[model samples]
Target: MQPPAQVPPVPPPEEEPQELARFREEWKAELQRRRAATAATQASSSPPQPASSSESTLPASPPAKVFVPVSVSQPRAGPSKNVLPETHPALNGTERPTYVSPGLGNALSIYRQAVYAEQRSDLDEALLLYRQAFRLDPHVDRAYHREEMLASILQGQTAAVKKLTVSAATDEEVEQLASNLQNTLALSKPVSTGKAVVTGTLASLISGFPQELAFEPENELESVPIKMLPDELLVLVLKKLDPTSIERFARVNKKLRVLSLDSTIWRNLVSKTYRPPQIPDIEYMIPVIEKHLSDFRRVYIEQPRVRFDGVYIAICHYVRPGLSENSWVNISHLITYHRYLRFLPNGQVLSLLANEEHSPQQVIPLLKPSLRMKGFFLGNWHLEGTTLHLTNLIDASGRFVLQGLEPPSSAPIHSHLHHSSNTTSEDRARYVFVMSLNLRSRPLGRWNRLDMETYESISLETGDATPVALKHDRPFWFSKVRSYGLQV
Candidate 1:
């Protein structure tokens, strides 16, 4: 047999538009059919308008249909205006994208539908409405709140970035705050004269909070660049700062913290008092963290950073928008590892119950380590909140207690402490999953007013409950954090 009818090798066929064009036509036909079916159903669903029999005489006015954004009830902060609308490319050699607003009615109509759905418990519909509202005006008031809630549930803290700085409320709070806003353009008002008086004369205060002056500039005290120092020296400096302060130093500069989230500092945080014989890098922190802490783990580091102490955690979800899922996963793992999770990536010192049974057990892992959930600090937690993540701090006492933080505006302003009652499970629900710390020191030396401006807080029974009770009153959350080998 002639081996086989030798057939010339077939050349690979060139791309063809025929099949592609055929698919396009098919899609178009299907879409048209769907529209036709929709129209037919609408026609059949409504009864014919009585054919205007006998040319009716009475004039009937159409109903007034009011329009509201879907997330109209969510909390909102500051003023927002349309910034970007469409996905237009940057003008210059920049990659930043611009938006093109498609007009109000077009977007507002969609928003109304979403709000309608939310009213009916249609979560998906509510989400769609928020997206539409964003399209109408990225800066829409309640639109931001609605969007944040969706993002928090869907994407967690990593996505709660822009939302945290703006909206933080349930529907009612949104309405009241919007009306209370004194200016549409300003997010915050000037420091009240009373506040200034209080903060200015804090030393004489009774010692309410651990410290109201959070590392203010002290003469030559200055923050230095991480790049300027040697890695060894850098490591040395980081060693001295307690884990809390080291985390704060990381956020002081995006580039700085981004570069510092390595094993050196994280490792030292997990260990048993690993102290560096010598220290370098005069200003800022980093070195202090390495020297004070021990052990390191990969799970504790990420772009949406978190730094912590035994009682508190600083959640840093300020990463730019449009992050990949993998990066976000690592960001979230810290929450699971630490266990006491804060929904938003905002950070705060958890008050450590040093004597609590569930307190942390020191483990040797990274040879440098900690974000101890249950531990002792100054005493017990009182209240905490913030507009942005407060990851920056200084815990000089080393009991994993927070030593540096500005007093809350109300702290010094109010001369007396306010009390809140939590008698049942419902009352305690708010504190269940939050990151916080309480400080305790026997009635050391009592003073009526510390430096005249700052007033001291006494006991919890006598402390002010207003700060912790009105959750919506403040634009912050008690952030949870994990560190080094503490990956749960």
Candidate 2:
């Protein structure tokens, strides 16, 4: 059958993001309409307006509907006692806060209820009520306060944690206000990214129906869609997403799960997320990617007949030149191994590889608030060669930190130039040069003068340096393969 006609890609308003954007707008308009109706009724009940008839529209904007946090426990009711005041301090205290009433009153009422729920610790009830308010009308706000509250709590908890251990900044109060900041920035981001949205009835998750198309900068779960993304931005988002979320998303929908299986996503994840100088074939890399992805559907890890890692790497070597079994494949790249493989959770298998670089190198390409990052590795390349990578190496908490060149180093170069020199001009120049070699910090980590097997600039600091790093990822495959081992 002929393929679908190619549509001339105009300036898409974020192709996949329309659903989310529409979803938010729909909510905002509804909130406004409800609030206006309530105000009209209130005016009718009061004395006639002055000749000018000014009190036209409420100054407040419509609020976004709150998302209910997903959890294992059933939702419960809020405390019966009222926690928040009926009105803000500036407003008339006697006026009963509009409770999603006929006009602007209803929009304000929902907002009041959301805040009140949090203060009373009626979290579940508040979330439920918040959603109810949003379902009735989603204007007045850009984000659903309850849902934002939930996501914020989780994010703050994770962000404030060090190695999963609680940090000093973590506190009960701080946790409560989680996801709140999303509201402040909602206006800045559109609702959709390639037609994904959170619209539909409350049972959308279970029903699996397509939600409305809208942009949601604060919707969490990678609100930015992959619409017309360049390789650079694509690599960055893939690198930072929480592994679990990507895995879960794959299981949620067939269309979305395939995104997690993108070849580039895995290639970068293994090369940068793990260590460098290790290049496994698409076939050999699939298992690890599938293992980590855990989506209901999985791609194969290797050719139908070749199951061994050695063969897989060897195959990739043929596909791209010198890849080997010892090459590292980050957990995400497992899909490269096969074209069709269904990977599910609870299945277990871990295949280990080797690196011999004793003189550890550090490569960090990106390190900033934004998702973009980069890094490099000069540890070991092809294991068959007589290289120093076979000698200097150590396993620090699963990450292969470079310990420096091995004694029987592969490179035949003398160690004379390797060590730091005296403060003389030549010596000082040498020190500065080596210090500057590091892709990360000049004083801390340094890069090797020679290119690694991939011919990408690999690093080898003076002494053993941890090789794990982050930097702006670039295409490092066009050049000839350089020997990564020391030539002393």
Per-residue lDDT tens digits for candidate 2, residues 42-119, read 588678522321232322223332111100111122223322222222222222122122543465477667656545
Measured by TM-score, the strongest candidate is: 1
lDDT of each: 0.29, 0.27
Please provide TM-scores, in order, for all candidate models, with all chains considered together.
Answer: 0.18, 0.17
User: Which regions of candidate 2 deviate over 4 angstroms?
Assistant: 1-168, 171-178, 183-241, 244-488
Error of 1 at 222 (Å): 42
Candidate 1 runs further than 4 Å off: 1-156, 160-357, 360-488
Tens digits of per-residue lDDT, candidate 1, 1-488, equal: 55778889999976644644454465456547645875896599667542222333333222222111000011222223323211112211233211112454356557666655555556676787778777776555333233322222223212223333322322233233222221121212222221111111221331343322232333456864434665557556866766556767766543344334444454433232211101111111222322222113221221012222212221121122333568545332111111121221121222221111121232111111122211211111112211112121112112111212212323321111112221221221011112222222113311111111111221111222122232121122232234432221
Give candidate 1's TM-score. Answer: 0.18
